[model samples]
Target: MLLTTVLIADFEKAGRATCQRLLQLEKKIKVVGEARCGLEAMTAAAKLKPRVLLLDPSGVEGEGVYLVSTILEKSPKTRIILLSERASDADILDALSQGALGYLAKPALASYLTKAVRAVAAGEAWVPRRMVGRLIDQLAPGQA
Candidate 1:
């Protein structure tokens, strides 16, 4: 029964709180840290070294990309999941391209979020159903 440590990063306090509350219901999921900004998120990831990072890039003044890149560069073991309102096909593909292991929409149900965290922690990619083909195309071309 190993618990999965998670860091919640969002622009709004309520966003962080909502995720924290929802995730706490799962015994195996622990909310280790919360961040209200990209800088805080990066610092928390470095210091806390949580197993999963649930990042919402919306409030980061477009630095979300850089934040993700640096966090991964600094903490390669921290698997990042983008939990954002930006749900366009391009956004999904871009996030995955930028090294996120999972992407969930803003209104995601608690079950989906928890399931995604577990799946990503277990080394699997998670994405909305519609984006699966795009994710595959994005990842596979590089392997060829």
Candidate 2:
């Protein structure tokens, strides 16, 4: 079976471990690399070119949204999923606007994280169900 490569960019050991454990359950997903900070993430993204990037911006050097854009600039084909504990609606929308393909809350469930990785790698957007209405509202504005 073909494998979808994933790069994890998270500073916390616990966060990385959780992601790795969750993703490992899926036979089609393979973790190619990991980064502890923003610069490492940028370099890894360029070098590994993983199919999906799971990013937690709290440990990054610059702003989370900026890192997302920068990574996308370097590896345009790599899909990105933002994982955060304190992600507000505005923050999620901003990252999505900056080219993030997915967003998941920190401590993401295994099902959601794996599903998101697969969806994003397949060129689809992934966000929590609760955020769907808000996302639609943001994207369509008056229409929602």
Candidate 3:
């Protein structure tokens, strides 16, 4: 059964396109609402109580992680996926530290994003392959 409700929080034309693509995959993901900013994302989370929150790191406020934290607090069951154009290690870690379940780059394929959503919905964490080395370097500076 597809029980995942996806809420997208992005403030760009690409964001809207992403939403449209997700809508096309309606059977796999149910998009409950869309928000153009982190603050609005929080409000939507509270109201929709979606299973997945597809958040863009470059939203209205410069504090997307903080917004993720708020969403977690407001809706403990909601899983946050930080979607962004940049794949910096700092960005990925910060979002993970803030309780985000996954991170994906902007140009990421819709299938990849959908896979992340399914994994997150099933209580798994995801970090994109392109940023894996960067993430490893940050997590274990001397180990790699």
The candidate 1 region of ten consecutive residues with least summed lDDT is: 135-144
lDDT of 1 by residue, 70-142 (tens): 8898788999999876667887677777788888877874658888989999999988888877666676875
CA RMSD per model (angstroms): 2.3, 1.5, 2.4
| lDDT ranking from best candidate downward | 2, 1, 3
Stretches of model 3 off by over 4 angstroms after superposition: 130-144
Q: In model 3, which range of ten residues has the least summed lDDT?
A: 17-26
TM-score of each: 0.91, 0.92, 0.84
The lDDT per prediction is 0.85, 0.88, 0.80
What C-alpha lDDT does candidate 3 achieve relative to the native structure? 0.80
Best by TM-score: 2
Tens digits of per-residue lDDT for model 3, 101-133: 898876774658778888899999889766667
lDDT over C-alpha atoms for residue 46 of model 3? 91
* TM value for model 1: 0.91
